[model samples]
Target: MEYSWIRLLVLVACLFPALVECRVRHYKFNVVLKNTTKLCSSKPIVTVNGKFPGPTLYAREDDTVLVKVVNHVKYNVSVHW
Candidate 1:
């Protein structure tokens, strides 16, 4: 039983990095200003690519993603994901 567990551990350690790695996805996020009046009053708001809820990002298992955000407005911007 112990020998089988050791073998399994070794197999997992060797094959895990090779099966899910080396995939890097680059995404560009443009923070711009837009006016929204969907619910009530119209006001200027910040958005990514002119979307209210930002943009949809997709990734797979063990994938590396990099997001580059460019600020077009006169405000300090920060992103959390």
Candidate 2:
């Protein structure tokens, strides 16, 4: 009897759909070196799309963001998110 109630609850939950608007946002980050003295004092520093601090990604609630990062610099970079 208890197992039947649990099964019914599971079936109902599975059949119920989420009532939320979901959207996919796409952004591309191009890693390159640019001449700037903001952070790095000496030579050119690695930046995203020629920006010093990179770009800001903004999305609404329940939004899925997809980022594509392309490295054009000679050195490998590991960006901490």
Candidate 3:
């Protein structure tokens, strides 16, 4: 009974840091503007899915990643490897 309690306490202590290191993130909204017709030809640069740099990523050191990106924009979106 006493040995079981000690083992449980050790397990909890080891797992606490792994849980706390994960962070939560939120982004603000954005709007795009453009002009058309016979006059000054103006174009607006907009964010993909209302995000400039896009989503926040979290990972530990030396972790393998396999992710797919889906573009919702009418134009091309570039990501450097």
Candidate 4:
């Protein structure tokens, strides 16, 4: 009887993660290098979609956000949330 109870608890614990509901969101970003005179210098700066500050990412609770970044610049770029 004790063994059956232990087995039931283990089964519920294993299946708990599968019972949760979640959604996934996807986004794409293109990285490029452009020349601009923003800080008193016309230097080439790396930006995403031609923007310096990048874009705003929105998501809800229990929702997963997946972003695909493409780089076209000569330098390395790293993006994080």
* lDDT (tens digit, per residue) of candidate 4 on 1-81: 999999999899897975667889898899999899976879887888888879888887789999999999887888766
Estimate the Cα RMSD of every predicted model relative to the unseen true structure: 4.9, 7.7, 8.8, 7.9
Instruction: Tell me how candidate 4 scores on lDDT.
Output: 0.86
Write model 1 residue lDDT over 20-73, tens digit each, in one string: 556788999999999888678899999999897889998887778899989998
Candidate 2 lDDT by residue in tens digits, 1-81: 999999998888788746446789999999999876655576888999888788889998889999999999998998777
Write out the backbone clash pairs for model 1: none
Stretches of candidate 4 off by over 4 Å are: 1-22
**What C-alpha lDDT values do all the predictions have?**
0.88, 0.87, 0.54, 0.86
Give the distance in Å from residue 50's predicted Cα in candidate 2 to where it truly belongs: 1.0
TM-score of 2: 0.65
Best-first order by TM-score: 1, 2, 4, 3
So what's the TM-score on candidate 3?
0.36
Q: Write the per-residue lDDT of candidate 3 for residues 2-47, one digit (tens) a residue.
A: 9999999889989785655443333332333233234565556555
Quality of model 2 by C-alpha lDDT: 0.87
Clashes found in each candidate (C-alpha, N, C closer than 3 A): 0, 0, 0, 0
Clashes of 1: 0
Best by lDDT: 1
